[model samples]
Target: MKINVVKGTRDLGPKETARFQEIIDKLDSISYFYCFTEVTLPIIEHAQLYKRSVGETSDIVRKEMYAFEDKGKRLLVLRPEFTASIVRTFVNNKIHALIDLPFKVHYHGPIFRYERPQAGRYRQFYQYGVESIGVNSPLIDAEVITYGYAALSFIGIENVILKINTLGDDDSRNKYREIISEYFQKHIHKMCHDCNERLQTNPLRILDCKIPSDQEIIKKAPKIHDYLSLASRERFNEVTKLLDQSDIPFEIDQTLVRGLDYYSEIVFEYHYYSDEGKTLGALGAGGHYSHLVKELGGPDLPGVGLSFGVDRLVEVLKEIEEDDNEEDYNSFVLFYLIPVGDVKIEDVYDVLMELRKQGGYSYDMYHEKKPLKTLIQKAKKRDARFLIFIGEDELKNNTLTIKNMKTEEQMVVNRQDAKQVIRSLFFSSMREG
Candidate 1:
């Protein structure tokens, strides 16, 4: 068999990779505006970490986790989601004990899934996520949702819809799970395999079933908000009030149970129209899971957060790329130095080093070993804006010839003055991020 990339993976060259970076960068910028510093958790953790936190019965841990045993026979798993790992970090480090109130932070990196690949879905993908822990206030829940919307909007994902729902508080959710299992007890055989599994494992997840028959039946089942305890209902109302004051539009989607079972109290999803803004799919999603910190062995503090599907976001951007018929906006100013012969190559090398030392220029193929005409053509192909000719005449006179590729204007200057000319084109350190 011929060698190639793995089945559900992709090799992103410069252009595609840059696009990916830009999207992530924009998200980080938006997140920073909302007081989210960055945090990094490991890719692999003990298998029990996810099993306990995300629930062993949920599709993520049950069917999708890429779990294996290390040399020590310890069960290790590539993280399927960020929240579990984030909480594990917080608990392990006793971060809650150190920080005051809500510990706001964000994470950005690859996430693994073993599901069959399709449009807007990939086996190996990336998630740029944020998590706020330690606070159980309703405003914190609303803050989590609104900040997610802000990240998407900052990236120009205009067609996103905010789907809001509550899983009741921790206590009320246990009751709702019980009611659903009892209500759908006899209908098990008629339900889809996933639903049947979810029924026993996480009954609330059954409400998210895609089976046409079961969906109709599940819709009439009990709404989770009805079961919310006094504290739970009041917390949900406070979250809604903050959302209203912030003027972020949302819809109450009772059936919007997350794939993982850790979410509680307040939950929501940000759905976006894919490809040419047509059908709906999740570009990003997140919500509150108040009990996760406690379950992960942390203090009795609540947590809430969201993560964006970078693969889907890229897929949507690809559609826009094709529609606009444009590639990445990359402008490379190739500085080509003309060389007369190998004898003068050392001088050209020195010039290249000097340009790089100035901190804003990149040059290639300018040695005297390469012909001047050949290097000039290479620079042209790269859309170079400035052509610097360093040849035998310049070496003797100690002058430099600078050609502006844009205006085709040529100027001859002393060696020191040439540095000043190039410096004017690129900004200094103060202007950089």
Candidate 2:
């Protein structure tokens, strides 16, 4: 019997992992320039934590959470999202007290949900995000969105666009909710079940419904900006002003209401388009939360953050990869070491270690029984740039033979000086290229 893997999940082979890491590295590098430090967060947390911050009415908490009761009869869950967990860590650790104000930190990890998966959506997926806490300035909001856009651009994603909006603070949202709710009530019976449920729970979420039939009713719903207070309006205006000054293109999407309860004021999404201009969906999203920190038992510090769905972004990258006919950017082993006649595998391993220590891309053939021709062919198939043969003759003579597979050029160097010679050759090759 074949044991099938879990639905809504798939394994990432070496090629995928390499591409994932490349995107991650670029994100980290760009975040560092923006002064955001890295923070590691737990994959599991108390189920109540999300219920508090993510809103009990949100789809993620109400339906998608992978929740269970542990042996201690305590409810735990594999996190469906990172924002609440990060906030919980900050509160529980008293990170505010230890760190300076306006603390910025980034995180990358897997998140689990029980939703029906599809292309670019998974039950177990990865997310990378950064949180800027302890401030409420609109500039910070602009900074978060800018970083989100920059990250997608850095990964070679093309034709990306930013959609931003404001949900206002509690007072504005409360008033706007009342208006939209009453409007939806008139047409409630004709809408989908989800929107009907949302009309009673969180009316703002109804605006985000994707049901084709509900969208027309959603479009007629009261806009949030009409209810925005003077301060809230100016706050959103300032965020747009900053993005404008930075020359970052964006549109004010009045209907953009994040699925989380904590998100207030400014919210945004990075939408990606393929080279052929096909919309790939939301590649990244985030917003500001004014009450989350205080509600989570931390200081009354306002925060803003954004998260990139690594899985979706990977899909986008794969599409671009095929379109551009790009070769794998990950390292292809530069050389393969083969142990020949009467030479122990250890001999080849020693040279392999030295080559690696000097930052040379290399691997070793352990079984000496394989013919030299076969080993060379294996190396060629792997796209290895060179083959180093450790034979009894070379071992006795204390010399190494390095052959450039592509050019069919061979050279001999004293074993004691092999590392330096290889380093010089590698560096020279890089410079010439």
Candidate 3:
């Protein structure tokens, strides 16, 4: 019997895995450019970590998280997001007192959420993100958001628009929440059940509802800007100003109340637009969370963060890569080995290893002998630029036949110099780059 993969999960085949790795490599390089160090976090955490940081009313906590009691009778959850886990780490390790200020770290891993899966979404998904703690400056908020934009740009994603908003500080939020509550109360009966509950609980969430009718009602609701305290408004304006000075384009979106409860002050999301008119939801989002660290048992340090949906970003990257000019992905392989006639592959294994030691991307077939036509087809399929044939004749003659798949040119060289020629080709490509 064949065992099928779970409904919302998949095994990425070889090519797809390579493609994902390529995207991640680009992101890592960009992270270095932004001076964000790397950190790792566990996938499982005490359930309270999220409930406290994400809030009980948020959809992730109330309806989506995969929480269960372990054999120890302790409640644990497969992390639905990274911010809380990272914060917990920060607190438990006493990273605040031990490390320098503004401890910025980037992480990449899988996150689980028991939700209805759709295109570019799954119950188990991957995320890449950064958290900057111990700093409350609007400048840091702008900095992290710009880093996110730059990372996507480096990956060749096009037509990306940054949508930003301000949730204001605590006092500003309280005043705005009261106004929002009062406005939504009158239409409580007409709104969806979730929206009505949110009205009395966290009315800010109503703006995020997907129901068309509810969205229409939310549009007329009071905007956060109307109630932002002087300090809150100024802080927000400064963030936008910094982004503008940095030449990062963005627009203020007052209704963009991110779903997470920990976020406040400057909130931003990255949206990618395809020329084909396909809409891939927010590629990534983040905002200031001045109270989360304190609330989660850490020192009263201000923090801001953002996470990109790796699955969604990969989808976007694939689309962009597909539409790009073919020349962008030149078909070239470092080396491909073929065994001709009755010659055993074992006889040529040492040569293959030598090529690998020289840092060439070399591959060989399992079969000891195969038809030249079949071997040539395999070479073409793998995009092998240099094809080397191993046969009794060449082995005895101490000579090698190298074929350039690109130009269909062939050359014979002494067997001992094959590695040198291969290294030369590799170095030539590097020099051209």
Candidate 4:
């Protein structure tokens, strides 16, 4: 019987795996530079964690969550997002009392959501994000946005527009919700079924509806900014001002209420576009949550964070690299050992081990006895920089033949001097650079 991968999931082959690692490494480096320590959270948590923190009215809890009952009669769910789980970790561990005032942590892993798979999206996807807990200042919010922006820029995703909005404080949101609910009630028949349901549960969610027919009605609905309380508006202003001072370009999108319900105050998304001006939607997004920590049974501490869709970012990187004709440096082989006519594995095993042990180098050997032409083709296929051949002649003369794949220059060197010769040839230009 033939079996296949589950729908909406994929196995990342070597090239994709390499690209994922490269992107993750770059983001991890940047996170460390910003003094954000790494944290790993479990993939499964009590189902109520998301339902309570992410909101039962939200789509994730209402529709997208992958929930199941364990054998122990316990309801569990594969985490749909990181923020709530991270907050739960903080609250459960009493991290606030254990660590500094604001606990900054970064994390990366696969998150499960049972949604329709689309381009750059999947039922199972990866995310990298940072959360700064126990901080309420708008300055921290701005810094988080800047950090996300800087990370995307570092990953070669520069053509992004930062779309920001404010959900305002509790009072502001409550007032607007009532007003919007009343307005939508009058035109609810014209909107989608989900919008109609959202109007009854969380009216703000109507603004996030994607149906073309509902958009006309949503567009005419109230904007959150007009209803924002003085304090909420001032907080939004401070965040924008900080961003301006930092020279990070952004747009005030009044309709951009993030999908999660816990988000309040300032929220933002980094939207990427193609060279021809086609939008690829949000590559990453996050917002300030005023009550998430307290709601999760922790102190009434505020937090801010953002997360990037790793799968989407990898796709974007592939596009950019393709457009620029970039080389796959991650796959470039430093040395390829070829065994020619009547060459035994034992004859070149020492040299292979030596090259492998050397720092800042990668080496692979053609173990099977193949013709010289076939060996050369294999080396080329591996994108090898240098091809080292060991055969009867080399075994007898105690020498090695090395050929520069790019320059096609060949030279024989004493077996003991091979390492030095290869380093001098490869590192000369790298050192200069």
- Model 1 regions more than 4 Å off: 274-277, 321-334, 340-346, 366-373, 427-433
TM-score per candidate, chains pooled: 0.91, 0.94, 0.92, 0.93
Evaluate model 2: give its TM-score. 0.94
**Which tens-of-lDDT digit does each residue in 67-147 have in candidate 4?**
999999999999899999999999999999998778999999999998998999999999999999997798889989999
Task: Identify the candidate with maximal TM-score.
Answer: 2
Sorted by TM-score (best first), the order is: 2, 4, 3, 1
What is candidate 2's lDDT per residue for 48-73, written digit by digit as tens? 99999999999999999999999999
The TM-score obtained by model 3 is: 0.92
Error of 4 at 308 (Å): 0.7
- Give the per-residue lDDT of model 1 (tens digit) for 1-433: 9899887777776567777899989998988899998998889888898888888787887788899999999999887888988888888888867878688999898888889888767778889989998877777888889998888788877777898888887689888888878988877888898887777677777888877998888878878887889988888788888988998888889899888878776778888775455843777788887678888887788888998888788777777556453454444654667666554677788877776776657765443465667877867877676787877788889887877776677888887776677675334222431
In candidate 4, what residue range of length 10 has the lowest lDDT sum?
323-332
lDDT of 3 by residue, 169-264 (tens): 899999989988989988878889988778867999988888998878888998999899999989988988899999899988888999999998
- Judge candidate 2 at residue 176 and give its lDDT: 92
Q: lDDT of candidate 2 vs native?
A: 0.86
For each candidate in the order shown, give its overall lDDT on alpha carbons: 0.79, 0.86, 0.84, 0.88
